[model samples]
Target: MPIIDTHCHLDNIQYQDDVDTVIQTALNEGIEAILIPGADPKDLPRAKMLAEKYPEVYFAAGVHPYDCENYDLDILKTYITHPKCIAVGECGLDYFRLPEDEIEKAENIALQKKIFIDQINFAKDVKKPLIVHIRDASDDSKTILMQHNAKEVGGVLHCFNASEHLLPLSEHNFYFSVGGVITFKNAKKLVDILPKIPLNKLIVETDGPYLTPHPFRGTRNEPKYTNNVVTKISEILSMSKSEVSKLTTENAKKLFKEFDIKN
Candidate 1:
């Protein structure tokens, strides 16, 4: 069975020097499709360019929480409709790295919420699914997603952090993605919760150049490593690697309807 890397940042600087080689390597590894998520407005064009260069590649358009400070929703909207632009994020609340000062932290949270909500609306408007990135702000992320009726379009909780509280989101059209992190020896939290994730709602990703799996721990991550994630999921769920690959790829295609899966 073929695999789809549901989330990756091929546009990141780490892959700049040999992106083609990286992409070809994944393809050679049976990765049939690759989705490059939008993290910053500046990276949008590069992402789109890659999508154009590779028929099997797709991209999303939204500002990440870290870049929310100067985000202009209108500017991001321009690329959301592109045929290769498959989703609306890599966007959501991230309070994990906020300031220590109370006032600054509060301000950062408020800005993140505002930008995240706006992008949620944009996804609804464009009639596309989302590519959410939540970290240390599950409550607010859940509240805002619920309040905004984000369930209407659905999305993937990218690189899911194993918060079972968010499991209810499976019914709300939110799928969960497991990344290379699940392969870590200390990923007991995620491993414990892996089985709870609905089979149909589980997708696989690499979050490349970050969260590189065990053995490759300190090395630069790439899309080819997605197979390692699938292997780990197989071991955890007691399923064959091919089965995990097929189901996860189907789940991804189900969410990203724009991608007509030939497999």
Candidate 2:
């Protein structure tokens, strides 16, 4: 079955020693495409370079919520025009880890919202979809997305961990992607909600070098682990792996139209 690991950080330092090997292994493992999402502003250049190096690889350009400090939108804009830069994010609100001080926390949240909104507008301007990252702030994220009329281009809720309350966003052109976290034994919440998510609105990913799936939770994740993600989703949905893979791959291509799956 063909697969697309829609959110991986191949340019991260963890894979610096053997990114070539990692890409080849992922390809050999039947991954048809891999998207490297930008987190820090400085990483976009390297992400762009990697996308250029591999025809099967693509990337997005944006600053992650945590990295929103002193973000330079100018740099992001410069790369957003790159043919290989398929989306505008990996950008959204993540209140999971915030400053301990009340004042700092409030300030941080505000900054996150600002940057997220800016990226949303950037996506609109470029006529590209977003790759949103929301955690511990799904309500706020949903509100902001709605307020900005982000559905004009649509996007995926990468590594989706929000409440079922936000599931209705499917009508607004929002899709979801699950990662190794779904394979965890204690991921009961996510597992229970798995089937609830419309299959066509779901895609599989491996947030590589992090969230390694069960039985390999301690090791750094790689794109090849995407197969494990597909298998688990199959088990949860009571469907064959191939069926899940094909549908998810199609869903991914549908969201990321730049993939050119015909090749």
Candidate 3:
């Protein structure tokens, strides 16, 4: 079975010069499919274009918390209905870069929360799974997901942060997406938590243009690096690389039902 990179920012400027080559390289290397997440509304068009041009590419439509200030539901709705647009997000709370001023930080958090909740509801309304992005605000993200009854739509926690608090989400129809960060030496926390995640809830991502895996840590990331992530996961889970790839690809297809993998 081939691997699936469930979350990759192929629309980023980093791939502007040679995206076609990048996609072909990943396909040649056994990466069966790639998902382009919507971080900024400005990038959704580019994402959609890539998805339309490549049969193996699909996309999601939602704003990242950092771009919450520009969250416009109307604009997102335009892309959400695309045949290749399979999920609702890359959206959630990101408290990693809040303002230094207490008042500014509070306001920023409020805006992020509001936008996150709105997206969650939108996903439910559309009856599509979500591609959530949670950072340092795991508690808030978990609470919001539960309160909003996000289980109705389920989701993949893009780049799961090894937070024990989120493990129970597996029962709520949420899957944990492991990425290149798992190969980092300092990723002991995630390494330790790897086996704790239910195998069925496991999926893989590259989060390309960021979190490039080890031995290539300083370089740009691409979907082909999903192979590195699968290798690390197989080692941690005491399974073969093919086993890990099959399971993760199955989990991804389960969550993003629109994925039309022929093989």
> lDDT: which candidate is best?
3
Candidate 3: residue 233 lDDT (0-100):
94
* Cand. 3 Cα-lDDT: 0.94
TM-score against truth, every candidate: 0.98, 0.98, 0.99
Per-residue CA lDDT of candidate 3, range 1-263, in tens?
Answer: 79999999999999999999999999999999999999999999999999989999999999999998789999999998899999999899999999999999999999999999999999999998988888899999999999999999999999557998999999999999999999999999999999999999999999999999998999999999999999999998899999999999999989899999765
Model 1, 1-263: lDDT tens digits are: 99999889999999899999999999999999999999998988899999999988999998889998668787788898789998999899888899999999999888888889989998999899999998888888898999899999999999556888889999999999999999998999999999999999999999998999987999999889999999999999999999999999989989998886454
| Pairs of residues at least 3 apart in sequence or in different chains that clash in candidate 1 | none
**Rank order (by lDDT, best first):** 3, 1, 2
When 1 and 3 are scored with TM-score, the better candidate is: 3
What is the overall TM-score of model 1 with all chains considered together? 0.98
Candidate with more favorable, higher lDDT: 2 or 3? 3
Give candidate 2 misplaced runs (Cα > 4 Å). Answer: 261-263
Cα-lDDT of candidate 1: 0.91
221 Cα displacement, candidate 2 (Å): 0.5
